[model samples]
Structure formats: structure tokens, C-alpha cells
Target: MTTPRTRMPAAARRTSILVAAAEVFGQRGYAAATTDAIAQLAGISQAYVIRSFGSKEALFIATAEHVLDLVTDAFRTAIAEADDTRRIEPLLGAAYVRLAADRGALVTLLHLFTLGQDPRIGPIARAGFLRILAILREEAGLSMERATAFLGNGMLVSTILGLQLPAESEDPATAELLEATFRENTPLVRELFGGRDLDG
Candidate 1:
């Protein structure tokens, strides 16, 4: 007997659409991502995506903001759960390494950064970037230099992730960069790559 697929709840379905949109936009960039592909990936109708998000521009904005929310939320969780004795930086790094498994979100941030000249997206992107920086300073209680270094390290991780080099530990340079970039989070990176390790 063929099994029936259960319908996704409204919130879940919307989250799925946003996720699919992020992946499509990350892969194709904002200009080329289409509602049809996003719908297909989301297992929903294109009409639903449009009805929900209004337009491609609106969808892009929502997706970009959603990605920002995920990053900030992860950071908040790390801060909350961090041990008072140890530095929160490593916990935050581990949290980020865990989140970095979402290549779509990682790459979407990069694509978002390139739209600095865009009238609509430019402000959103800049604001989101600063928002993270601000959180590191005001909420996370990191000094100016530590916060800057944390964000810089995150960008480096993003760059390595966007390059897709961490998929395997085959290339010497790729392995070396992965080791260097992910240093303390090497085990998490290995887990993300499915048992692949720095040994090779």
C-alpha cells in the first residue's frame, strides 16, 4: 500500500518555504532565484509561495531576515547555556560550527553582502550585519577587540564554507584550512562531513 503524506502545519510549511527560498537564493543569488524552483523544493505550489510572500523581492527580504534570525538565535542560545567559569567564546564558536552545517544559510549571507548597492536589500543586509556585531558587544559582553575578532572569525568560516572545501578532507590545503579555521571545532566539522577527519 502507498503511504499518504501528512500535510504540514501552516507554520511548518511557511518555514519550509523560507528554507527552500534560502537554498535557491544562495545557490542562484537573489536575481536568479525563482518562486517556481523554491516551490518545487518546498513541495508546495508556486501560487502558495507568492500568496504567502507577495513577491520575489519580498521573499528575498524575508529569507535574508530569517537567516539573520537563525544566526542571532544560535548565538543567544550559546550565551545562555555557556558555563560561567569558561570563556563563552568557545561555546559560541561551537554553536556557530553546528549552524555552519546549513550551507544555504551560510552562502546566503555572502550573496546578501554583495548587494551593498541595492536600494532595498542594502540597508537590510548592513543592518543585519551590524545587529550581530552589536549583540556581540552589548549582550554577549565581549570587548570591542574580542567582538571584532569573533565576527572576523565567523566571516572566515563563512568564506571557507561558501567555497565548499570542507565537504571532504581530501585536499591538503582544504584539510589544512579546515583544521585552521575550525581548530577547536574540528570534531564538529568532522561530524558534519560524515566521519571525514583531518587524518586524511
Candidate 2:
């Protein structure tokens, strides 16, 4: 026997759809993902999914915005919690590492970034990216160089996750490179990626 699934409020249902959309879009990319897949993941009808977001492109834009909000909130919280101004970069980096465990939003945002040539999505992606950079510079009070370095390291982390490099434990060179690359954040990386192989 199984319990019946309770109905969600409209707002909650919308959010649920977005969460499912993020996971689907993250795995399949915007071009490949379909509302039917998202609806299946969300345990809803395709009609409801379409009604919630209008279209796949609109849903993707919403998903991108949602991901940006998550990232910006994480940075804001990290900045607020930092006791030492000098430690802000590491704090923010740690925040991102923690978030990367979820993988959906982060990977989806990465997919969004590759659409830089799209007249519609390109501006949204570029603006969202620049917004994060702005937060690091203005809100986090990091200098331009430091902010660039932080973002560069973040991009590297994204790549590592995207490539499933951390799961290549048998490759000593990969292990060594990751160890050196993450340095102080190596433990977090291990925790996030340890013993996990990429999905087929």
C-alpha cells in the first residue's frame, strides 16, 4: 500500500515545476529538454507545466533566474557570515562548493551560459553572470583582480563537476591536479564528489 500524494498550493506547485525543470534542463540542456519530461519529473500533467511557465523558453529563463537568485543569496549569506574581510573569497568559494552538491541549478546555469549566441537567452545569461560578478565586487567588497580570480576558480570547479573529474579516483594525475587545484577546499570537493561516478 502507498500513501496518496497531497495536492500542493498554486505557488508551491509552481515552484515544484521549476525545481523539476531545473533538474531536467540541467541534465538535457535547454534545447533538448521537453516539458513532458519536466511534467513527468514533477508528477504533474504537461498542461499544468505549460500553464505554469507559458513555454519551454520562458520556463528556462525562469529557471535561470531562480538559479541566479540561489547563487546570489548564497554569496550574500557567506559575506554576512564572514568574520574577517580577508576571508571573504574563501567563504564565498565554500558557499558555492556547498551548493554544487545539488548540481541541478549549477549545471543548468552552466548550460545557460553556453547560449551566449542566442539573441534572447544570451542577454539573460550575460546579465545574470555579470550580476554575480557585481555582487562579488560591490557587496563582497572584493577588488577586481580578486573577484576575477574567484570567478575563475569557480569556473574551474564547474568544469571539474561537469567533466566528473573528481570521480576519477584511479587516475593519480587527475587526483593530484584536483588536490592542487582545490587546495584548501579539497575536503569539500571530496565530500561532494567522492565515490560517485557519472551517470550514463
Candidate 3:
């Protein structure tokens, strides 16, 4: 006997598609990634994926925004859960490290950064970067210098994680870079690498 198909709520189904799209777009750049792959991964029909998001471009944009939301949401959470006596920088850095453990989302955001030259995605990418900067500046009360420093470190984390460099910890250069870059979050990043899901 065949098992019955599960029915998900519309919101849940949309999120599911976006999740699959992120994985596809993250692994394959937007120009190369297709809705069919996303549909197959999502266990939905390509027509349904189009019906849900209108088109591939729209779906890519949605997925990009979704991952940006994940990053910003983590920052907001760090801000909210910050210890009164402890510095917010380390807390925020740890939060970024934990969230960056999701290789798909991190790579997707990096892909989005590259698409900043595309007419369709450029403005959105710039706006997303500024949005994160604003949050660090206005909400987190970080000065421009501190925010820049954090962003620089975030880029390093993204690059290291994207390249799976931690797996090369035995190498002197990679080990030194990861050690200096992650510092206290080194163990956390190494442990969670390819181990955690963003949606979790």
C-alpha cells in the first residue's frame, strides 16, 4: 500500500519552497539554478513553485530576502538576549557564528552579494547590507568603527565557512586564520559546521 501525501499549511508550504530554493540557489548560482530542482527538492511540482512565487526571478529574490532575514533576526535575538554586564560585541559575534553554521544560508547570502551587479538584484543587495549596518548602528548601539569591524569579521566567517576551511585545521595557514578569526567561537563554528540547519 502507498502512503498518503502530507498536506501542509500554505505558509508552511511557501517556507518549504523557499528553503529548497535557498539550497538550490546557494549551491548553484541564480543563473544556473532552476525551479525544477527546487521543486524536486521541495517535493512539489515546478508549476506549483511558480504559482507560489510567480517566477524564477521572484523566487530567487524571495529566497535571498529570506536568508537576509535569518541573519538580521539572529542579530536582533543577540541584542535581546545580551547580558547586562557582558559586552554585546562578543554575544553578537557568537550569534553570527552559530547562524553561519548553516552552510546553505551563508553561501546563499554570499551569492546574493555577488549579484549586486545585476540590475534586478543590485538595489536589493545594497539595501540589505545597509539594513544590517543600520541595525548594528541604531538598535545595537554599535559605533561605525565597531560595526565595520563586526562586518569585516562576518565576511571572514562567511568565506571560511563557505570554503569549508575548518576541515583543513591541520594546515598551518588555515588553522591560524580560523583561530584568529573565530577566537572564542572557534569551537562552536567547528562543531556546528555542516551540522545545523538554518530553520532549526
Candidate 2's residue-wise lDDT over 1-200, tens digit each? 99997867998888888899989997888889999999999999999888878999999999888888999999999999999998888788888988777777878989889989999889999999999999999999999999999899889988887888888956999989788777788888888786696433
Q: Sort the predicted structures by TM-score, highest score first.
A: 2, 3, 1
Q: Kindly list the per-residue Cα lDDT of model 3 for residues 103-189, writing each as its tens digit.
A: 667778998899888999889899999999999999899989989998998898888888777777777887788889988877876
lDDT of all predictions: 0.83, 0.87, 0.85
**Global local distance difference test of model 1:** 0.83
Q: Which ten residues in a row have the lowest lDDT in candidate 2?
A: 191-200
Summarize candidate 1's per-residue lDDT along 86-144 as a digit string, tens digits. Answer: 55888888888777677678777888888889999999999999999887888789999
The TM-scores of all predictions, comma-separated, are 0.87, 0.93, 0.91
| Cand. 3 TM to true fold | 0.91
Candidate 2 — which pairs collide?
A: none
Measured by TM-score, how close is model 2 to the native structure? 0.93
Better of 2 and 3 by TM-score: 2
